[model samples]
Target: MPDRLDPKRQFLADLFDAAVAAADPRRILQDVLPPPPKGRTVVIGAGKGAAQLAQALEALWPHPCEGAVVTRYGYAAPCRHIRVLEAAHPVPDAAGIEAARVLQSCVADLGPDDQVIALICGGGSSLLPAPPEGLTLEDLQELNSALLASGAPISVMNDIRKQFSTVNGGRLAALAHPAPVLSLIVSDVPGDDPGAVASGPTVPGRPAASAVLAEVTARGLELPPRAMAFLQAAAEQAPAAPPPSRSTTRIIASAALSLDAAAQRARARGVNAWVLSDAIEGEAQEVALVHAALARQAQHSGFPHPAPLVLLSGGETTVTLRHKGRGGRNSAFALSLALALEGQAGITALAADTDGIDGSEDNAGAFVDGASAAAMRAAGVDPRRLLQGNDAYAAFDAVDDLFHTGPTGTNVNDFRAILLGELPDG
Candidate 1:
């Protein structure tokens, strides 16, 4: 493909690359590996980054450790000692059910001398869909779809998922019983809560079913009937604290770390960079509006931060699918941001998922700038209509602005950078 991005666009893209590189398992996972146990070390995990974590673990550990980890299709990393299983993500499927079973079996029949290293990261919630007893995978699948469309934040969705899951909320650790579990996590959630990542498979503590159900009702999320009924009954029963499990969690990589890395890169290039937050959340478009306001302020008023500055933020954003659109939250944010800017000059922004897949699309995300809307019109595309239909992919593709960086092998949620100042003339 022709190089369509200018130097300013390339600068934003470079920042994103720096952010993702900061979370690479091979670079960050080695120092956190625990000492090998005397009996056995079982490796089990699920997420977009699980396979990469397995590959890193296999390379770092001297002693032999064997187990399996599940990742999204097309995300497998080769490992000699650890098995890498592929499964669906953001939605549960039969393959995910089997993957969950494999993970469960991997940690079972272990002794106190044995140890389990959990390679946890984002997307594991969907990859390991072990439905609770009395509920079927179909029920969990239905719930998963509803949750994704409900526009709820990831943490809220995970709270509800913990109620219906067999493998989440530290049950995986409890299942490993006598064997201690050490969860090496790449956090994708806001606030860097280790328990919120991958629904805390190794970390203990499940909120009461009643509380989860209440939150669901408050959010107006319509779960499947079977799952809803189960939650109702479980809610009535005495809420029991989760059984104590010997599990230690370490957040090896997170959005904060990645954002810091991006800022450092910006500074090295002689641009002042200010990180807005590493935990920004809400509807993608709404969040984009806030970012647009900031960019405008910095560009026109020179308040908050002066010109030639880049504002950085990292966190997961949601896209409530009101239309049958073909774009993820990152793309949606870019589109909305373009509209909000109204062709304002001297402002360029990039929004992308660090995993190199935004929602279910092939592209990681897209770039937007002062001219994005004008370019869409010139291409005979209606940017407003596409944005309303939740089809930001078409908007960016119309302008040849869709950013692709296939499967980065690790994830730390969204990476957004907005640069204020015009690109220098060649």
Candidate 2:
């Protein structure tokens, strides 16, 4: 007979697998495809999922189409007609600059007869870098570094980014105006705002330039002079044109959809699954504490759900990187959660990114159990010190509990699960 799998552990793993499946571009594309235009079709996108979306489009497209998409290095998809360009993400690089040039040039000459399909998801903000005039790539990079470390919400970050970009804020779609643009999106933001995804390369939203300035000043960020001037100029310009009239956008996948799928899988396995807010955000450590409180509530009061329940949540959380750590927000959340639990029996949790890369680390995230604290103590790893250093990767690595799932070829955000009560008897 096969070795028996722990029911609770198996349920959690299955839930994660289901969540990953829900974000697959191959599946998502099938549902959102518009009919092939009688005119020329051009595919352009940027994000961790761009290449995968490009590949899927190529596979499903019945007519001949051509274009290019940029994705992070090592995230390239196999394609023939559609060029897959690898670019830097979370930070723009030379590759992204060149890729942006290609993107701009692709639609520059298109007429009304041509159609553009923009496959946008997360990370497009950095990958589709087209710095405003008088600003070099370095200036943008410096500003991006500050923004990433600022712990600002995604909305604020994108608002600041729009002023300094050549292609963002619906400029890309504007470039191809008169050409019908269809955007198939895999939303990573809480509200599924298309304008926020990839900074609204295809969709447009008018967040005031003054708002960007206010946010930067409020955060006490010292932006490069050129960046500041760009924001000031944008504030003066008419609001970013509304999403192109020629553009029709559709959200094929989102974090909430994936979380719901996970909950369904848990129910099938005879476990009560409750979906917490799919828009949960904030400091990673603080979010863990909140989750820990929920776990405690379920254990003691059972207000949300009774014992033998699993709490599922999906959202992109941030970590103000104060320490020179070797982990991402998900791992940091897991480590902090383990500390808060303090070996309280009957709780097991896992936190991992849907894209299979958490923060800048290779591992997706980490897992923790009621005995995690004791295990760390026996291993001579100081959880508090690790948490202080933001070295959640090392802390979890020491106990061999880091969750590694490589690239899952999709991005919806973070998926977390906390299981309560004893494992079902075999």
Candidate 3:
């Protein structure tokens, strides 16, 4: 691990901190709040950042608000008027089942005069599970587990998830038909589509059940019989657009915004920074190889830009589990990057999730330099073997390079930065 005085690592960390700070609810939520409603203002949400988003709303909105929100365990933030509930993430639990009911109840029976404010963020698909009729939570849980290991993109997974859920696909907003709903979203998906985020509980639009089934089949996920039956029946029904509601969605934060913030911070420090893309998605290792190729281009030929530049990109990546590894897509990308950049000099990179939790692991992600692969070998660990085993966590840990930041009270998906050549002086 780099010491506290390591200028290169510190610079990269500063850029990441700036990106996360840009997405903090307290800092960005105040400006977009709607006017006080005529009737009751009920807040209901589900995600890793739902609690903090509720707390931010409470701090900003002077009008009395009452309701509940569900978040991942250990991510609850204090709220004065809104109730915060905790549940499992990446997989639904019984607590999530109950919380989903509570969320539905909050918006139920609301009149046109009332207002419903939904705080949606990443991890909500699992944090708020409402399986359709004839399907059990266990079925949903099993499907979720399989999807995570199937190496499918998040958008595809959510598309299929909407077919089997009672609350998603704008059903949550449909419940509060007469009431006006304002969905304040922190987008964690590629393209920042509000409907795609959290499976679009508040936003209306669902692919035909037939299309969803095709996606499921393409992914080769073996859902339970009841779950499969449910999809088939829905597909047999007449295709129709979801009922519209008085729902308006606004993306309060996203990977593009966060990447812009990081790039600005890098520029202020005199480093030439370029944001490659905020929606790069693919297999984790393959994405890392592309990034490595770009870095080498900048280092040797300066084709895209001169040396002393940091390449920034953000997007969710998927990993096909060849083994039961203890790492997320970000760590896998970092490990692959380490091997790809082996024997090169003066290249450093960081890949982590902005929400500060990756794949139920302790560290958000990992940091890799040109020498990271060699360092692992020095510690009696082969980087290639670990990568093949899908155990980047152990490889990075052996070199003391795992990045940890607990929970950052926000979610904007992946954050990655690669600096080639030498660090620029302030």
TM-scores vs. true structure, each candidate: 0.98, 0.95, 0.97
What TM-score quantifies how close candidate 2 is to the native fold? 0.95
- Residue-wise C-alpha lDDT for candidate 2, range 44-100, written one tens digit per residue: 998998999999988888888988899999999899898999988788999999999
Give the per-residue lDDT digits (tens) of candidate 1, residues 280-363: 999999999999998987788877767789999988899898889899999999999999987698888999999999999999
Model 1 TM-score (2 dp): 0.98
> In candidate 3, which residue pairs get closer than 3 Å at backbone N, Cα or C atoms, i.e. clash?
none
lDDT tens digits, residue span 1-426, model 3: 445627887788888899999999999898998899889999999899999999999999999999999999999999988999999999899999999999999998999999999999999999888987678899999889878888889999899899878899899999998999999999999999899999999998889998888878876777667778888888899887677589999999999999999999988887888899999999999999999998988788876678788999999999999898789999999999999999889999999999998788988888889999999999999999999999999999998999888899999999999988787665
Name every residue pair that clashes in candidate 1.
Answer: none
Q: Which regions of candidate 1 fall more than 4 Å away from where they truly are? A: 1-4, 423-426
Give lDDT per model, in order: 0.91, 0.86, 0.91
lDDT assessment of candidate 3: 0.91
Q: Please list the residue runs of candidate 2 whose C-alpha ends up more than 4 Å from where it truly belongs after superposition.
A: 1-7, 222-226, 232-245
Q: Relative to the unseen true structure, what is the C-alpha lDDT of residue 300 in candidate 1, on a scale of 0 to 100? A: 82
Candidate 1, poorest ten consecutive residues by summed lDDT? 1-10
